[model samples]
Target chain A: MSQHAQDYTPSEREEHQAMHLLPVRRADLPFLISLALIAAVYIVLIVGILAAKVFYVELPLIGEVFTNPGYRYAVMLSLISCSVTTILSLWIAVPAAYLMTRVRFPGKRLVDAILDIPIVLPPLVIGLGLLMLFQTPPGAWIQQYVRFTYAIPGLILAQFMVSCAFATRSMMASFAEINPRQEQVAVTLGCSRSQAFWMVVLPEARRGMIPAATIAWARAMGEFGPVLVFAGTTRMRTEVMPTTIFLELQVGNLGMATAVAVVMLITSLVILVLMRVAGRGMRMM
Target chain B: MIEFQDVSIQLGSFALEHVQLHIPTGTYAVLMGRTGCGKTTLLEAACGLRPLQAGRIALMGRDVTDLPPGQRGVGLVPQDGALFTTMTVADHLGFALRVRKRPRKEILARVEELADWLGIRYLLPRKPHGLSGGERQRVAIGRAMAGHPDVLCLDEPFSALDEETHADMIALLRRVQRDTSVTVLHITHNRNEAQALGDHVHVLKDGVLERQDPKLWKK
Candidate 1:
């Protein structure tokens, strides 16, 4: 090799020159443009839908629909049922979460995976499955004992199944993030396992639990498919807000349906705000 | 006295096997080892946090091998202090007292005394996260000591502090041990810490305990 050429390799010299150049490559422009285009399209579609719903729809009858005694009853029933569902789900989920995080036993992975199945299953499928199961002989026997079919209990059960999965998943994550060493330390400081968890772990996990509860509650509030299939849309009986909205939409009562949707949206927003506040509190702790 | 008789535990790849030792009453013994040498595991096993696959653990002449940690009469201060993040310093100090059903005034009085002793009287109202690492460790030690345990297990308790703070804490721990007659099983990776704080030192390697020469002090 010539002395001059030996002083520096062609690759090294080229690398040196490239290092001085701005790192942005020609290939990035297309990606940036595509991302911008997708964002714009998403915003435009959302705004267009909102504009149509606000201006073109005959929504004035929504105010009268809210005043209707039957609608009010449906709303109240939905709130009460969903609240019960949320509480029931949390009651089961907190202990299940504790067991899942703190203890190691056989079939724990299987139990965890099974708990997560409802999240992946479609709501309509879950409803149909529940309906079929409850309608069968073994389920009929259960109904005789517990009254599972065409009742408020059936609606709560369906909502519980769907919402519990979400609550459990959130709570499990919360528990996992907590160092088990904290509880161990507690035990060393003269706390029983349950005492350690209740005093230390639960308080730390409370922030995550709050959001999880809110999500479950909102999910129960908007629950329609399972409630319709299992509970039967009986007006002033098993009828809930989502069921009422479904019935109204079926009968071409667009104004009432939108009003119910608006109520649900507002409720969800309030719950989300509460969850944020709880999350902030947790962070502070 | 806290005694371990050939205790062995296998947690995944790490194993603490055939570990036998004794910490006599009111002795300041330090377990020195490198990282992953099972010092923490030994402390945990002694406290009944980890189930022993073999052998036994005894505290003050009673075989507490199968006993739960709460009944073992042992206090532990973990690395990073492990202060109850949800609790104030006073609350952490009062926790064991409350569990033992001690009177409210007694608990408060003891907590106040310990807080004053540790120079954490002003930190009584603050939670663990708000305090500095040294303050948290002090609170952890105070909380453990408040219960009047048979033995105090400190696992690398001074490793989180700066050099000056580390020295101060070692001196503080020594002073407390002298005044309280509490048996301490302090664990550390640093030989200097072992020398400074330990009356008897046990060097651990791969879960095996080996006593080092008392004269072989590092620095």
Candidate 2:
């Protein structure tokens, strides 16, 4: 019955205050904590580099780096190697992931456990392992036929071994998210297994491909330790964008080193944005 | 026609033990059971979606126990319709014909005919996410029939619809039977649905099937 602005019914005032308190009360603490932890990781690894770039990066030096023959060769190798690595990784991962998700086999759990090795192992250890493999008798036979160590091919191979795991993991997640019932229905409606796969299952898994390929490409772009050990940091030979930074830092040109680093950061961001956009477009279609 | 004799299959904790079933041609049969009673398992075994552990399956008088599902000439409309979310309704209807590599003109014409018959021509371009429960089921039925399969197996197809929609779908099935002679094995838990739609009804309990309501649906 009170008409004063502050004199309100309990129900009406509570409803008004509830709007303000609801978010604070119902906030998903665990999810926010999980997201914040992941965000903290990105901020530390990525933002630290960007912050370093703010002091060391001079816009005019970009042209100097671009014009240098060594830098140009590094950039070209990075582009070419990452592209090949991404393609090879996807080619290997797609079918492997399909099997991992759809098939039931005796050693499947072991095989799945093995896939995480490259992902979890230290980068230098992978390079060292590749080096040891090349030194073995069977590896020697292949080396005679196709020399990889200390060569451009070695650079690609090292990147491939490391980045392929990321590709496979993402693709496995993609394939796992899809329900097998759709393909089963397709089969009963007269589609052979392969037909069902290519028509129904593959199309459904297309969204997964974007993330798989993007993450692999970014990983390949930043690969340093494996390339340094297995491929060697030879100028105009196995040099890539990451090696360019190492070479610059060797001479104490920290500004020039961070400039190359800044370029990689920009490249990685652009790549992720493109993949997300492509994924959204495919979903809409 | 579909037949399963001495069929034994297991999936996780569920099993179909020595199950025997027969659906004669041109009949709309309902297989009724409580939820998780393995009714869908039996249906899937006949369709070759699940391998039978120890028995024979025959489809349209052919011994297809060891054959692949596509080779068995079965058209399945699974629970929730299972329509490909990415495809249009027209794509769903034309899927079988496309898989068989029918000529484009023939496939399009057949799709149009089915779309008209199922009253989903206007919804053909829409994706599954936009359709109502009844609309999705209609598209699914059309899709299943597109292959001209000898047997059409629907697993709880109408269980998701409202009462009005359920009745409408039942009437649609009757019309579909008038138009085509496909043998249908529909799985459901509802006694009322069995009474309304079945020409021959079978009750499944503990992985065993028994013919029910002899006086009501003698055929």
Candidate 3:
């Protein structure tokens, strides 16, 4: 007879203690070791790159990069732009994802495909497209009032375009994982649809928003080809931290470039860690 | 009274055709069916969670077929309680009153009353994660009753409990239905449970509902 877990009696359960205590099989070694070796290569590569950057640049160059007005301004601008982009992305992503997950509407697949265009399009292509769009009549009309081509606003727009797709994807998965029955129960208990969303669904999705924001912030920080193509590398004008690396390299300042790169790397690492810790705390609660 | 008059529902490939059921006021109704037999789907239709393809549902003699789940004046305890993972037990108990913007004192009084009645007063400050399965169901029942709803729909409320816990829950549900005098439609697959608690027992088969005598279930 086939034995199920719940069907085990007291004597059978005692016998099953041996099943739980069984030693690791020798046949699993090759599979386990191969997977570990492949994983170790990626970890070592990341550690090696960080070590090379630290060693290639002098410590004082890192300090000088921080103290330099142009570089400092670039850092501030990058931070501000990334924060703003993350906020705006979340503002659109949360509602869009909730609707996409819960509500059935006409042209949903078409809308979904259009939203994924940014994620699939090459970074340079997005910048080129944005530039071309400005040249169009309607785009030109909007540009007349607000300059987006080769401006700071272009930097945010570029980041938001790419990052929002990722945020929306994360949020959609988050909402999908939550059981809709809770919201149904809430509605049956006198809450309207909007009230159930705000009270029940949103609270349960708090953990998901963390990863979405972190991914968006990281994407914004690392963005290069789009910002470089759309927004020019004008020092103290539209230059962000990523562009700082390009600009420093252009002037034969390799150490300064590596230092700026290191700063970006460390900033991203710190924020990722902080966000993960916050997510963990939320899960515990 | 709660009534499902010639209801027909289609969900993807699964369909419940011409389902009919009635439970008089202040009675405990038990719905029994095998797994995947559309018992929950039928319950959802009555609660306005699912739209019927044909026919209508009436609650307390009111035609509530087109009414939204909230406006239908029903409280649902979905499978495994479906308790809000983020809120405290007290928050769950006070949720309906709070949403209606009832007085803070009134909400607190109702919360206390339900908590004490459900014997979950000590669990008031804790969220659902730490709650035992039986305790969670009690809290769910308390929350459902907090709104003083005209009807309570319980979906497989005791399927997860041990024998002892299940017996306790049966007694508790009986007491709750008797004291509150609210109409209840409880779904379960266990025949013994139907015999233990039901005033009117039903069985679903081949997408049709049939009223059955619980005492004659053994035959």
How many clashes in each candidate? 0, 0, 0
* Candidate 1 chain B weakest ten by summed lDDT: B210-219
Ranking by lDDT: 3, 2, 1
Query: DockQ of each model against the real complex?
Result: 0.27, 0.37, 0.49
Index of the highest-lDDT prediction: 3
lDDT of each: 0.82, 0.86, 0.88
Winner by TM-score: 3
Winner on lDDT between 2 and 3 is: 3
* Candidates ranked, most accurate by TM-score first: 3, 2, 1
Given candidate 2, what's the lDDT at residue B164? 90
Kindly report which residue pairs in candidate 2 clash with one another. none
The estimated TM-scores of all candidates read 0.88, 0.89, 0.93
Model 2 residue B121 lDDT score: 95
Task: Label model 2 with its docking quality class.
Answer: acceptable
Candidate 3: fraction of native contacts reproduced: 0.65
Candidate 1 structure quality by residue, lDDT tens digits, A206-252: 76678679878988987888888888899988988888878999999
Model 3 lDDT tens row, A1-285: 112232222345688797788566789889878999999999999899989987887788778767989889999999999999999999999999999999889999999998899899999999888888889999999988999978989889988889999999999988887778888998998888999999999998887899999999999988888898888789898899989898888899888899898888889989999998888787777
**Any residue pairs clashing in model 3, and if so which?**
none
